[model samples]
Target: MKTFGIMTLNFESEALYIDGIAALSQSCGMECFHFLPSSINPLTQQVQGRRYSAIEQRWFDDEFPIPVLIYDRCFYGDDEHSKQCIPIVSWLKSRNDITFLGFGLPNKLELYGTLTTSRLAPYLPHSQSIKDCSEVVSALTKQKKIIIKPINGSQGYGIYYLKKNDKTIHVKTEKNKKIISRIFPNETKLCQWLQPLINFRPYLLQPYLELSNAASKPFDIRILLQKDEQGVWVERGKGIRIGNTGGILSNLSAGGSVIDFSTWSSSLPPAGKEYICSELNFIITNLPYILEREISPLFEIGIDIGVAKNGALWILDVNSKPGRKVVLQTDPDLKETLFLAPLLYGKYLSQSENKERKSNYEKTLYH
Candidate 1:
């Protein structure tokens, strides 16, 4: 049987999702293994990880040669372990003998730049990298309201909404399901807080869109796109993510609720419904191909789309390594399909003639 490996930074990171994939691996004519990048023995090239035993339906302690195919689910942070494992993963990607289901996307700023030149450019909001707090203050002063987010941020962390008032500035963010707000007496105070933040990491600024609903709860449409057994892009599912009232994010991690897409769209008037459907169809159809052409191949993507009160659509964010919560919550029947996607895609790659061909594109795209 062919070998399929699920690589993650932590063994317990996606325990349930990993378990589902491993449980279905044998039926797909593959053996499953789970491991951390740090577990690889640099000298011998063998990995100390767990192998799934189909007969027993359990994982056992085992060491083996690196798997032929890898499903990377590593989420990096500013930590010592993340810094160490990054280079090791990069080394693995450099090898022609191994196949990864997909090469991840670049950071937010790079992604914005690439998409800005594509046909879908109209859907993207104007974005600029922040060099200092002065840029942010200038934007807020000019735009009146804007969003500042980490260039490498995920899960709605490190995103803030800034609004400029005559003598004061307001900053708001959602953390641990709570709305945290602070009133800066002046731009100098806000700059004091923003200087350390911009120094710590890169950030991007864009004008804030009013993405809230009638009740003042922020919401966005979340869609999951993936490659099938034949390596064709397909929409797995989509749903509505509704955040807390007065919140800036609709990410589940920020105390958001999920609703079926049909339920929400049904309430819209015919004209508005048709317009939204058309715009969404255009974005969904073109985004994947654009990313692959300008960056690298990808197995799956999670997109967050914002809707303004004036009926404008905005591409709020795109994630190469998306979570399954929104889709599963909206449609529980897709559980099996989601679990088998990696196995099937990996199998297709292993059997294809171009299995070992690596993209000559720069490898900096992986985050």
Candidate 2:
């Protein structure tokens, strides 16, 4: 029987759902092996706990006796324990015998200075990254309002929206009190007010998206999209995250609540529903293509879309490893879809191996 292995930081420790995927693979007639980070030997570069059987010449756990297929799921490089696992992962990828299911080395996320702005323009709120506060003040002067966000930030942190009036500019945080509410009679004062942020990190200047309800903060939708066995794009699930009571960002990590989109959409008028749906579809369809062209070797994408008060859609952000919490919480049935991913990956590997074998046999016969 065919065998697949999951290469993760803690094989049996975290992401408990992965066990379900292994069970599914077994049901589909493939053996599953889990090679956790802790199992690796520091000196010999051999995995512990499981020994290779002489008869099979493959690593086995008694229950699973087949060659290994590594499912790279460990989040390394961030913490100390996970950081140590990076060497093991690197070693496995270098070896020709093991098959790494997902994108391998050289395709990892790189910190490019221009990548965030260039790749995320389509989805980002009306924003521009600028170093000069004068340019930001000028833009705000013309537009009358703008929102500023750090170029490289996660969750709902470091966001400021400024409202400009005749003589002064008012700047407010999502939840905090108004930082700048005085009328800046001079452009010099306006530039001085934004100097700290401009000097700290690159910031994006965005036009404030006026949400539908004046009382309700602006909200965005998080859609999880994945490729199935046939490599077809499928919507795993979607959830509407409402921002905190007085916050601008609707990120769950920032105290946002996940609400049912269908129910929320139904409460809106027919025209609003049509507008929202069309914009969402456009983002979902166009986003994957954009990532494929710009970011090579990305198999799946999680798109964050924002709907403006005028019924326009904008791509806010794209995540490489989108969290499964919202998906699993919103639609428990989607657990099956996640379970099926490894199985399909296994089948694809089997087909690839068979093709290689057939080619080798033909070469032998010809010689």
Instruction: Judging by TM-score against the true structure, name the best candidate.
Output: 1
lDDT of each: 0.91, 0.61
Runs of candidate 1 with Cα error greater than 4 angstroms are 360-367
lDDT of 2 by residue, 1-367 (tens): 6666666666454446666666576566666666675676566655544433434534455333224666666654336786576665656655566655544212111222223446444545544667898878788878887778765554556777787877777776654322223456677887877788789766777777764245576577888887666656778889887775455677776666677778778988998898788868876776666554443333356667777776767766666555676677678888887778767856666566332211111111000
Runs in model 2 lying further than 4 Å from the true structure: 1-14, 22-25, 28-127, 130-144, 150-152, 157-203, 212-214, 349-367
Global CA lDDT computed for model 1: 0.91
In model 1, where is the ten-residue run with the lowest total lDDT?
A: 356-365
TM-score of 2: 0.66
Cα lDDT tens digits, model 1, 1-367, are: 9999999988889999999999999999999999999999999999999999989999998999999999999998999998888889888878888898888888998899889989988888999999989999889879999999999999998999999988899999999999999999998999999999999999999999999999999999999999999999999999999999999989999999999999999999999999999999999999999888878888999999999999999999999899999999999999999999999999999898975345633454344
Model 2 clashing-pair count: 4
